[model samples]
Target: MTITTHSVTLDGVEQRYHVAGNGPVCLAHSGGPGIAWDYLRMRPLEEHLTMVYVEPIGTGESGRLAADTDYTLDNYVRYLHVVVEDLAAGPVALLGHSHGGFVVQKYALAHPVDALVLYDTSARTGAEFFGDAVANIQRHGQKILAAFTSQHAEMTNDELTDVLRTIMPAYFADWRVEFEPLRAAMRIWSGPSRGQDVPFDVREQLSALDVPALVVVGEDDFICGPRWAQELHRALPSSRLRVIEHCGHIAHVERPDVFYPEVLKFLS
Candidate 1:
């Protein structure tokens, strides 16, 4: 694949993207609300599809400002439109991971694309999970796990594994075994802006999408599991779902050997 990097103007701001491969272009959007695409390292996927990784306005080496930039979901979607046009490539596949999945779903809803890959992601978030699970984790974090140790004294490392294995994999293709590392390895890059709170609903707009969609997920993804992907696949008229064994949220990164071939099968 021919790899390249360049910049483009969108929303009157300069943005950077990494590119490679030679088939219908496939673009990647990373998670973390402001994570860098380098963490995804899509150069390998580049060999199968012309991969283009976009560094959202605030992440990576892209433009940054100290004022209100209209960082809403619609704004991000609009930014993606400008990106597709900038690529100058026809009928590209738009793919995203985790929170990146939310961005791509919004983008796909707003615009048309040849295909889509939503890797362990979601568009509609359950307040219960985000409010209870996420909030507690953010507040207590590792301490919360330590607290559990007090009650379930016998809940040793293996026991914890069993619990996570049962719950987390319902969302992933591979289950907790594949997802734990990716989740732990993920380094969030949110600016002090708290700008990720955008209310974008795919249910209202997704039914209108006509593009072929692929929902790739890990069995171990505790956040957004296989059920999330399955919901997406069932909703989109032109879509299919796949699960990567022994993989998690960042399935492409953790099990690239499996992810590449699966992605190639769909893209090819």
Candidate 2:
């Protein structure tokens, strides 16, 4: 939990990052494509790797792009390339969650990495991912639908948190339990980058990857389900797919016992 924060200029953008733990440098990226990096603090990872959590160009303490700058996937990859060159001593492990997964995949395609840990992620675009999500919800999402229907206007902070807790069950195999320890540790910092959705298809690009990869997913993840994980594994030449039982989108938070061991083994 002793994290050292660093800010450096990369290609004219003021990039901020947090480093913790000890061992090989691992560049970590959170999902949301916009959520604050704090949402991805995994203490278990600190035991095996020096975790470097990079705030996206416009998130957390990181600087923003110009008004006319293109927020395309290529630009994001360029930014990450500069970050890796600026921070990593050599080829470093790449860890990405959700949309961060997409970024990492593209990054690996452009710049090789020592290893890749893609959690609850896919190689498809937002449209394809959401299309699968809709079908997945229809098949096994009654509770989620009910919770969604019950949402009202302008909830208080606690009420909003309560609703989130209630709906979280749908994201897990166990729909009635809450992981308060993980929940309490998360930091919520919203920014303008939240709605920057870009379309991409990297299934072909993944086939050329040479580094070992770990494709881990939650069995109960509605958005990036087992099939997407499997698809990513199939596309990669050297990769292992692990589906954690009774888990959800946030596999590291939902099942660190399984996640940490698998990741450690892969990195080892």
Candidate 3:
């Protein structure tokens, strides 16, 4: 019932995290590879599970890498491993959204975990995935398309935050209704484009993992849609897939009625 925030020094870098609720521990990693952790807060799930929301390095109060470009998935996984060790809570469940999913997937493969929750994410970043995202943006309109294309390596934190707000509508099924509140609450920091230069296909590697996993995606999510979720399910040996109907990339925010229950049940 109590919420506490803590920061630890690892490898001379600071990593911050928030803890709440009381039950089996669940370590959550938010997306963006740069977005602050607050957006991934699951108050409903907190009632059933202890949630450790991670403030990933390069965002919030967490320390940054020597170079922004150093923010690779492997590096993220390394830091995450330290965080898990610091928790010393034994095997813990890992929940990752979008880019965070990529982190957990890599981490879970190498380390032991109670379970894995992959939300609105993909196992690989391919041309087809980005192509679909572009098509979805085109359908939405020019402003969003422009914002999507405007992203560059040199974007400042404030500039990137502005662009995220501008383009966030495309991340939801019904942006008109959801945009305002999310816009007000959203916080984005500019981090390096992670693992873009390296190949990120984990499909073949997934079969070796015996851990149980739950792959949940927004039915209407353009970038990491049901297609990728299906791909993840097919590859992971002990994985289940759940597609939230009438939702987009941010299912937890848009449809908690469905998202929270499904996740809580899986975790239970």
Candidate 4:
């Protein structure tokens, strides 16, 4: 299949997206307000759907905000609105991983979407989420925990990349076996936090949503683990939950066999 890259100007900033495969259009937003979009590419799903992998603003060739602190969920959703309108594909299905899931949740509530796939993400972010993340890293080892702790807004791209690589193993169920290539391929940008001084919670509003949603999470995801996925499933009125066995945060990469089939079936 051929993959085509395109860019669109949204509110004077450039946003890039890559499209491939066939069938219905599914817009995918990668995790990490900072991670490049390449890692989220689901080649298998592409066979059955036209995958539009969004290169979210503040990463890759996409434009950056004047101040890093301006990178909030609202802005991400706003830019995403423009991208969807540019596609002219009405009510496309949306798949969001981690941070992208937060964006998708917010967007779906306000706008009309064909469907939603919330992968390894939480509907809220607060002390519990932050505490769980720290606890998980500690279980791996203090060295990684220290690397995770060292992350600061002021770090340069190279510094942030180093920290991400150092803590990458924690993101998978078994990193030593088959995740080395993905680690090497990772391109992390040092963007600002979502700029939420208060907790980010949309659980209360999710019950009102009627859009079909599939909540998928790796059985062992550290940050947004099964707890969050179950919460999402419970909150969403029209939703189903799937937890892939022997997997972590990036199930699409770590367990494609299980991930793709479930996702395709949902989309179908």
Backbone clash pairs for candidate 4 read none
Question: Global CA lDDT of candidate 3, please?
Answer: 0.88
List the candidate 3 regions with Cα displacement exceeding 4 Å.
194-197
lDDT of 4 at 1: 81
Model 2: weakest 10-residue lDDT segment is 187-196
Model 4 Cα shift for residue 24 (angstroms): 0.2
TM-score order, best first, reads 4, 3, 2, 1
Tens digit of lDDT per residue, candidate 1, span 18-134? 777766788888775655566676776665567788877766577763443455556666667778998887657888887778888887766667888888787577564354334
TM-score of each model, in listed order: 0.76, 0.84, 0.96, 0.97
Identify the superior model by lDDT, candidate 1 or candidate 4.
4
lDDT of 1: 0.66
Better of 2 and 4 by TM-score: 4
**What residue pairs are clashing in model 3?**
none
Candidate 2 pairs with clashing backbones: none
Query: What is the per-residue lDDT of model 2 for residues 1-268, given as tens digits with 9 covering 90 to 100?
Result: 6999887785688878888999998899877655568778778889878999888776667887764234556766777777788775788999999888988998999886999999999989666676777666655567656544453334443554454455555566664336765455444323333334457688988889978999999998988889899999999999999999989888776787899999989898
Off by over 4 Å in 2: 138-167, 175-198
Each candidate: what lDDT?
0.66, 0.76, 0.88, 0.89
